[model samples]
Target: MRHRVGPRHARRPAPTLLRGIYLPRSMDAGAHAMTTFGIPLLVLATTNSAVLTGVAFALEWVPRLAAFALAGAMVDRYGASPVFRTASVLRALTVVAAALALPYSDGVGATVTVMLLAASTGVLSEFSYIAAETAGGAASRAAGSRAHRVQSVLLGIDQVGTLAGPALAGLLLERYGATGMLTVIAGFSLLAGLLAPRQRDGRAAGLPEPVMKGLRTGWSTMRSLPTLCWLVVGLTLSNLAVGLLQAAAPVIVIQHMGRSSADVGMIWSVAAVATLVAVALWRRAIDRYGLWPVGAVAAAIAATTCLAVTLTHTYTTYLVLIAVLMAAEGGMTVMLRTLRSHLIPASAFGSTLALSALILLAPFPVAGVLIAVTPPALLVHVMTGCAVLQAVGLAVTFARLRAAPGLRTALA
Candidate 1:
């Protein structure tokens, strides 16, 4: 049997430990931001085709849903360290290749190549994301009672990436072409790989099942939790609304609002600031006020933001509303994470969280395709209807969660 380390054993200082954890995560976030913003910008710049831009967007996300369950289950058996390190290295190498090769391709070939890159990047990034979250748990265990504080700091760091990453990418893209921007992104991803820590106790000896069996077990665990399932469904609906904004917002800002891609990056950068402020405000209140109530309020803000977008065409108005929506999104995200932790079993986190993410995120690329095909006027109406559906679904779910007797005790 394994034994615990004694008091005499030397433990790393919290700052040193946190540095090891945050450095990779911070760099990874930068890489993620660059990929998210750069791909669409590169596609549009190359093709000047909205349909192709949407295709690139779809390429990036659709594979994530396909990969998440497998990634999660793989992490369960093999540990996150190797998976993270290998994936980051692959991302670095792939992007480097893309930078060198992409300019040589013809129009049809370029579209196909970029989409393939997006798909591969999507798969690798999903593994990294699951690894980071798992690493956070390890970091928290090391921090002991300060786990919540550690998580808050991590959340803040993520916000910083979102706040600055796009702006940084936009600056680079504006000054340097796609190849230069990709080179920089590859560097960040490489840094993340190099900085990744290998926990001495990272492997899960408990999960020795075959790959397919492990996958099935995870699905069973996730489906058994009705509350969590409902929560995912509600969040999935919210993600569809999010997809509408994400896929449409860039098009709207550039085509409808007559701005540069840099402007769209700036808009997201501003939303990140708003999200940071919201996180600061909501963190304390969530611990005090509980999930359903705070979640309901956040839902209202989200719906209001969607409605405001429908009513405005001004660049400034769209920016402010996106900021508001992102703020609400940040708060709701924290609440949902906390709530999911409460509802999900400890053993099920890896697989179940992956399943949940698959559902919640699947809408992203679908939104892109929808935006691509839908006419502009009709798309606006589709978004408006999405907002209504989001509000109603969240309201009902929160009501159900509030009414459940078992959940009442834990709600606080």
Candidate 2:
């Protein structure tokens, strides 16, 4: 008979590789599937006019800002896993509804209304994403790096989907028309919903406290910590800068370069590839050096890269600039996510994390408006300035954190 023994007196326990590393990758795939279907559905269902499309797109962000706070509180009350599963299913159902509505819309007015409804429903998925990250906990911050590594990997995959979804939608639309495309989207949504149940067994049994209690607890906890407060503030500013840059990228490519759709796709693909590589490298670096220095370096690099974008005119030069900028952004993102995982207690995890997301996302509409109103030259200038500000803010925050013994130890 084979004998299995516990660690003997003279021996140590075997080192085990963490399984949580795979969890982020899986969650990321699920996120990619969700976004892939959601974005195309908006595109496929909308009128071809840029103005109408912009209006529909703008509606999507509206609910995201409005509902984020409540979603965070509810996530704490219900627990991340359960909330994630429920929202996934709800999002799938909403997509299915959008699929149904697509066939009926005859013109811009009808299409806009249906697309607006679709975008509104899609916001729920964002809530579920925040919850999933919260559930990741310290496993999210394993090896001194944060969820950013996982986020970057997943985001890379998501970008692939972003690249693929439109092409797939176009093919499907050509083959099966609007109805056929919607059917394909519905299938993706169903897959996403099915994936949710696998997150954690028995997650439903541990219902959190009431929403009010959870909010109060989260508020108290956040208010008590100076590090958490400043971190959120800095991240919020960073995200605002990111949002503006993102909204402006396509506009710059289209207007400045007079690029066709294919060229635009190529530019984005290059940026995505760069982000993926930077993130993978940043993850390794963070595991070795820790988040503070990695983040500081990333911020500085991002600032320079953003400024470089304004100077580039040729397609190759612009692509190179974008790739470099995205790399830096990807690195900073990983560090910030890791820091967020560290700062919050497990019990208040979802709410606190969600609050940070809410704050960070608060300026998206403003960024979008800036994209709409400002001249391309002015917008690019503003984005470069913002990137510089983000670098300075992150540096200052890092300095404050390094000086404070409690915060420094926590970060380390």
Candidate 3:
């Protein structure tokens, strides 16, 4: 009789998931950030109108925010590979079309063209992102007990992309003009599409779900998972405080603190570094202390730093506090991602991911409204109010999680 191989030994060798999934993800994310940030600056340059620039910002983000649910549904129905590849290819084409159109258009025509490009790309980017996120979620689930390590690395990769993307966008725009910058973005987007892994054969592709129905499904998934719901609630409150601080950063730095616009960028650069460090540390921390304790500690640190930021009189102090706050947030994010992979069923992962993201992001526009209406001198006070709410909410959330009998195995 011939010798038989065990299942593990018989499995075919494959490229590491990190190289196959995350490398392309980084390219996609950076390109999206470049286009999103670059377009507003381009609008300002082309129109010489701050109003149009502000319009460009809204056009870019509003559509992106709207696309999450639909994109998530598409990912669930069709699978991540096909959705990501199609959206990325379409995004590249859109950018190239805009670049080709820009030279011929003049004044209002140029402004309109750019705004349309922003809206289109914004929607496409969300589709790609949701698909990629679903793909990552599948990979995390396969990792089983080591899932948080996967999540920490993924979060770290995102932080790096976010840190580098804007600066790269500005540099390319300054050196190469609209066409050059757009062309570079298109290249990255195309590369991301080309690099995406092929879909596995076993998963079924189905008819597109209605957007509203998909959202309802996502909502149902959340309702089924009380632990996930409570974590989202705490994070949403934390984000409200973070969002207020972010929206108020430029005004506080340039007007209240008497710092240049350049300093605002520097502050974020520092904070991003802090976040990266925290993400790196989370894996080891989780290994030693487990997820719940690590998350609770992170929450406490974030809440403390958020409150302390209100007392800062100097730019340096504000910068340090913000960095610490972001670091803590990074740790919490890793914990969230790990838990999400464990809790949400694979069948609803895409749709539920969309709903969770929407909830987390809802605070941003609210923060923007607060910043727009509040006096600069009162910004700290607004942040203080948000911080207190975040602290109490998270404290309560963790306390509940700790006491809940249903969550012990999952948290363990």
Best by TM-score: 1
Candidate-wise lDDT, in order: 0.76, 0.60, 0.80
Ranking by lDDT: 3, 1, 2
Q: TM-score for every candidate vs. truth?
A: 0.89, 0.76, 0.84
Count backbone overlaps in model 3. Answer: 0
Q: Give Cα distance to truth, residue 358, candidate 1, Å.
A: 0.4
Local accuracy of candidate 3 as per-residue lDDT tens digits, 83-181: 898999999999999999999999878888998998899889989888888888888999998888778778877777656665566566667778988
User: Which 10-residue span in candidate 2 carries the lowest summed lDDT?
Assistant: 13-22
Those runs of model 2 whose alpha carbons end farther than 4 Å from true positions after fitting are 1-54, 114-118, 141-185, 198-216, 375-378, 381-385, 404-412
The alpha-carbon lDDT assigned to residue 143 of candidate 1 equals 57
Give the clashing pairs for model 2: 146-338, 148-334
Q: Stretches of candidate 1 above 4 Å error?
A: 1-17, 138-148, 200-212, 404-412
Clashing pairs in 1: none
Q: Tens-digit lDDT track for model 1 on 282-379?
A: 76665566556666688789877877777887999889998999888777777666555555555556676777788789889988898788887787
- Tens-place lDDT per residue, model 2, 1-412, is 9665754542543222223333432543444443433342345335544333334445556677666666777676665555666776676676567667767766765676566664665477567666656655545555443355555555555555544554455456555665666566556545555554343422344544555665676677788777667767766666667666555544565555776434555655567667777777887777676666676678778767766776677888977887787778777677666666667777667667666676777766666566656664576677777777766776676676665333222232
Error of 1 at 106 (Å): 4.0
